[model samples]
Target: MQKLSPVPYGSLIFAPMEGITDEAFRKTILKLYPEWDYLATDFLRVPSAGKYPLKHLVTHFGKELSDVGWVKDKTMFQILTSHRSFTVEMVKDVAQLGYPWMDINLGCPSNTVTKNGGGSSLLLDLNTLRSLIKNIRENFPGRLTAKIRTGFHDTSGFKDSIRLLNDEGIEMITVHGRTRDMMYKVPAEWNYIEEAVKISQVPIVGNGDIWCSADVDRMLKETGCHAVMVARGALKFPWMAQTYKRGFREETSHERLQKIKEFFQEYRTQLESESISLRGLLKQSKSVSRYMLDGVENGEAIRRKLLLSQTPPDFFDILKSL
Candidate 1:
């Protein structure tokens, strides 16, 4: 087992969620809770064919995403793929874009992804995983990492799977306890994550079912992982990363309300900075605000207002009214 220095590696991480970690969302989180170890971009789909060029792919990074500056330094640019050639070809462009780190995703459980022999499906083939990481290292020339589930169906390949990553010089690895079959239905098997921490030659970031600071401590205590990754937790409680830095203190109702107001204000500010259509900006803000406003007293009512908001001013009006 290995431990990384307590910089970004030893710090708490925001997981790369598909629709949740876009540019506006990342910016909002950074503004509110800048203590996060790093913010990861949602996985960029590396198509085996067709026009998956930088222009198309960059859109998912959203507007303000960059290789440097803001939101913690370890901003990971993650990709999902099964085809080596296509992934290799895309890696060149990714590196050229100046992204500091690139992650091979073997953790997403979507059928659309797995059925295409990407995502967790790659777990069933260690040789291919090794080859892809090796190819990426030889070609990309940047910090390389991979996020993986326990395995496709079980933990059978778990040890060798992480070994391939470490052996290939992957800088860090995040292990989500559920296999592809688990698909997040079951609790993330942290004991399995403990196993990875036991034998992994590189730093392991544990993921799954971590919803609070207590859970963070539990993951770290039980697994001795180098760090923890929070996904759904960050969505519902945007201040979660703050807990890691300052220790967990329950948010009072007044504090929650204040946080909500501040969060949306940042959201509006970020959207305006992007210079997108008001309609598009409202749609984007509403899309993410629902999570931030979750569990609040008037959450549903606010969501309804956002739904009715047709322009940026309307959106800001609703937020103000809240």
Candidate 2:
């Protein structure tokens, strides 16, 4: 069977996050820390109502597909859609664009997505999920993978979900350790991830609540997952993949602050090149700063001040003072 370009054991994946992991952010992170084994695109939602043109797909993936061979190699094209007909067509387009693998998003908990029978909503309907995967697998020539929450309302279907994906010839699975309803309010149940590893025929990647290197170690040891996918945690520490690859030493508070400064500078440059307006730039900056600053001293106060800033210069001035 075909497989995703192989990833090493204990690999670190930078999770796809909507609105936050756009081309600018991805390029900045890859520029700063090149150790990430895999990176995923934010889910490209295939419209249920019409044909998804190849041009739109090209625009969504941006430079990840158009330039930088290594970025293309490390990245996974992700799609979120329950419309099997649209998905089959979209997967064919994606394969023609040369993506080596594609991932189905079955873990998004947003009400907007679930209301439309996409994302984690599929978890509640296994028959639909199975059909969607089967259809895509039949159409796409490359490897196929999926990311799923434990279940819709509870984890009673967790093991069965793994079994189903395996049966459908899914090359890999990433299990986020919470039901759709649990969201991020509670601790991730790593035990379920361990169980997935046991029952799964392919690699199982553990995801959720991995905020630091220590959590990565714990998740790998506890769950025996083939890898760990960092979501919000990657925003918090963009250097995390590099840190883990470099043997997990704790960086000094000053070192971390300096890194944050550099990251924002690089991030700003990328966003500016994309022609984002000043207001747009500030909004994006704050979204990233909110997570990146959590470990810094007086971070909350700094975040509040940064939030009040009306312009990019103002935001950077406040960060510089820190």
Candidate 3:
């Protein structure tokens, strides 16, 4: 199998989860730990010319976001579209913004996005896909990458589709193990991702079913992809990125619990600094904090109470009492 530089190929990555990986969350992770190799913004849905205002582009990556020190050069902006013209215009605008890298989302499975000829729908039209990618390359300034699934429904036409992308000079490719039709339901078909690794020329990143640092190692050992990106895993356990960076060696349950406590304390400090009200602060961590119980005792019960937590102090008291 081919090998990349010593840089951890399994560098934990935060998927461009719309509404979930926003500035508030990104800041929380960055401040708490610097485990992620790069951060890809949630897909910026661009319908047509004049539809996506510059401010819209700027808001997601605009002043406030751009100022986040952790995201500056490390962040990749991902845009979704069906029209090559629209894609080119958006690329051009982002180029003007001085971004060093950008990604095109061809893996989104949202029904509304697909019906509009965007996201994975472009997969059905190879010619349109090639045209749009070509426009992006010709217009955008820095690194260009594409994030895709194994295929739309069947893997039959996947090779030709991937070839078109490889031939177009994309800098990298990140493939989610499932197709558009599969959504996030079934286990990721690592074998199919193995097939893609053999065919694609650019560096490949495997993403799917990676729930922990060990999972990251196993995915790389099995797929031969250059890197692995973690979405739900990172969300489930914020320290996942940090854990991988520190290596996947086993830890005692008590040690692991200690790490969890540190994560919560650090995260709480960040929330407080955001000037969010105490109640609001705890509410924000509710969804993701539940993930910390992965290796803990009575984790499900803890997650249940935390999910239903009404206030910051209430959640803190529960955590303390536990």
Candidate 4:
């Protein structure tokens, strides 16, 4: 029942990573590091044919929709859809569910999403993007936000995209400074983010390649964005946001390893309680381990063992030895 800024000044947000930032993962992260200013659900894709039923929306959002505690206020619901026909009605349903914050996904670059005329592909067609935003704004009375890449293939349309979002009353935009074509092959172009902040009427949140507490400060100082959103960086260092806000303290290698071990143990427990089968849990653990063990000592070898792990106990045992 209370409205909040989607991207408050100096806020730190945990980016919505598909398949990674699910309900269980969010709960685990919040339990360990509750300092994040906002948390976002991985985007819920709206079918082009018809409006999503209220029951289906509730199921997709999981328990966060029903939560009335502080977590509800800190969490935001995100949706992805290229079709404008059913968008307004679906958003109206979302409003009735009592979410005060919502975000449209305009940055996803996966072939499946783009080929369907959704995600970054929408950047190529401002007309459709404009119609979608205009309709959703008229129907949804909440903080309407968007996440975007600079452009589909180049930076030519980047400024225009920002202006269009501003004109449509987008309250905040998270700029992930890479064109859809560039993907993750090169470094993020923060200069474009700087340009966005300079020209936009709404607050901009800078996201890309932020891997540590220092990077968080550097992004804020460099881009002058209202906030910073951490994606893969959070997967690598789950405590990064808490460390940034509380002050980064030096940790010994042993201490870091212990913390990593404990974090995964908690994640494993959460997955088990959610009724995930051993095979499913193993798959998820390995997926996260790819990020978690990237820079740890002997991480490559540990990851190899982790990937080869056949059971949950074996997986955790390998992690514990690290």
Candidate 5:
């Protein structure tokens, strides 16, 4: 139950990415590098129309949730939903499950998610978004947050949406500076995010395309944001958080890869010691190995070999050859 240090502007955080940012991965990143200050879990889906009991939101209990008991204070439970009634119910469910804070996701751009009146699509209907925040504030007992994009198609529509959430007393806001339509195809618009900061009452956290400490510095300088959330950039380089803290000095290609390999070896041993099944463990390795090959020649070939292998030995053989 220890709290993380003061984050007026907060600090670098690992954004929740499904299939990639699980308990095991978080632990690996934290263990190897203790510089990351916050982490949002991959969102839990909420059923609509009150068809499902709220207990579904507590599904993390005793499973992945337990993995966070040691560091629960630094964690934020992310939920995907745009319904006021559903969000309120889900908030109650999360609090009852012992979660201290919850974050609402409104930035996901997946076609399926948007089609359901959830995710970024909510920006198109500010009333529902307002109602969702107002009701959660009125009923939910714990901290509430919203993670939003600039807008779905045009960012101009989100100004009022962000203002209303701030007015509703939401604790914090995370803005990825792109319209949902842009997806991850373009660089995040730091200027648009700066505009949100000007209008918002609550603390605003800026997200998108921050790859290193210099990117972090640029984000703060360009947008005057309180903090940043790293997604793909963190996945491509696990040491990014540490790199930010130490100041951005370019690491030689060879030095970078060597450090990554040593860390991967530590991660491998931890998986083995836990008695995790080889296949399940290997699945994670394949994803992590890409980052491990930063400077190696034809690293794709190395990744392909690891992808085909079923055992740790098979994957290690490919890594050793590199």
Candidate 6:
């Protein structure tokens, strides 16, 4: 099996968004625009209390991303968990598979993740967070990175969190600048990002509200972050990395729509190749179409048509109309 290498941190990176940053999306996005810096996998839910087997939890780790061909090296597996031993075990297992990097997902704000004491909820328990980091650092000798929000509720411990990361030798950290309460509300606190940059010893990747190339530039200039991670921004504009690489070139409606069509085809190929149920595929198709509709004038209308699609033929017909 061949290994993929990580993309250099030039400027832009794809944020690890659950249910959105799947292998198909990364592979397709890279095919269209190869300038993206790095991509973190959707957080892997670690097996807890030895209830589930390790093989079950790492279902998508080696095979799914590796089969995607080119994303092997550029992608890092992100693990979400509230237990120290489980995190250490998960990292060790992947490390044995020749996986070069492991990223801890400390910033996921989803209710499902938080209610279980996994995501940003860990932020409220800094002691456990620190122990988890330290254990992973000791167990996994290779590169280790962590993603985080400013704080659990308010960013009161933001500085302490940075200090913990540095002390534990986290090579890279991405800060989303929003607390659990914020939940991506209006206006990302870039000022908070700027403050994190000033305090951190390692490179800080700034995330949140970066809608276009200009926002990428603004993030770098204002926050002095080493890189920018785009989540909702990439969904809203799939061509963002390409535009940033091309100096933010303007794309006409026709051209952009064509790209969205290509995305539909790319994602369909991915779904069909996998072992998924029809209902699951349809749901995925509808969700992706919603994302692809972003700023298009006829987006809602097109999305409605896609939801009405009952079969593969119906979905393809809608793409043809696009």
| Reference-based TM-score of each model | 0.88, 0.96, 0.86, 0.95, 0.87, 0.91
Task: Candidate 3: list runs displaced more than 4 Å.
Answer: 1-10, 49-53, 62-65, 68-70, 251-257, 268-283
How many collisions per candidate? 0, 0, 1, 0, 1, 2
Provide the overall lDDT of each model, using Cα atoms, as 2-decimal numbers: 0.79, 0.87, 0.77, 0.86, 0.75, 0.78
**Best TM-score among the predictions, by candidate number:** 2
For 178-295, candidate 4 gives per-residue lDDT tens digits of 9999999999999999999999999999999998889999999999998999999888888888789888774566666787888898888878878998898998888887777767
Predicted structure 3: lDDT: 0.77
lDDT of 6: 0.78
Q: Kindly give the stretch of ten consecutive residues in candidate 2 with the minimal lDDT sum.
A: 63-72
lDDT by residue (tens digit), candidate 6, 1-322: 2323333555677888777777666767776667776776788887775534555544555356654534556677888888533666777777766566778888888898888888898889889888888888888866788899888889899889888899988988889989878987857898888988898988888998988778998898999998889988788777788888878775777887888887778877777777668787787777766666766778788878888999767877888887
Off by over 4 Å in 5: 1-6, 49-70, 269-277, 290-297, 308-310
- Give one digit per residue, the lDDT tens place, for model 5 in 214-243: 888888888888888888778767888888
Q: If ranked by TM-score, best first, what sequence of candidates would result?
A: 2, 4, 6, 1, 5, 3
TM-score result, candidate 1:
0.88
lDDT at position 40, candidate 5: 73
Best first by lDDT, ranked: 2, 4, 1, 6, 3, 5
Clashing pairs in 4: none
- Clash pairs for candidate 6: 4-73, 5-73
Off by over 4 Å in 1: 1-9, 50-72, 298-316
Off by over 4 Å in 6: 1-9, 51-58, 62-64, 67-70
The candidate that wins on lDDT is: 2
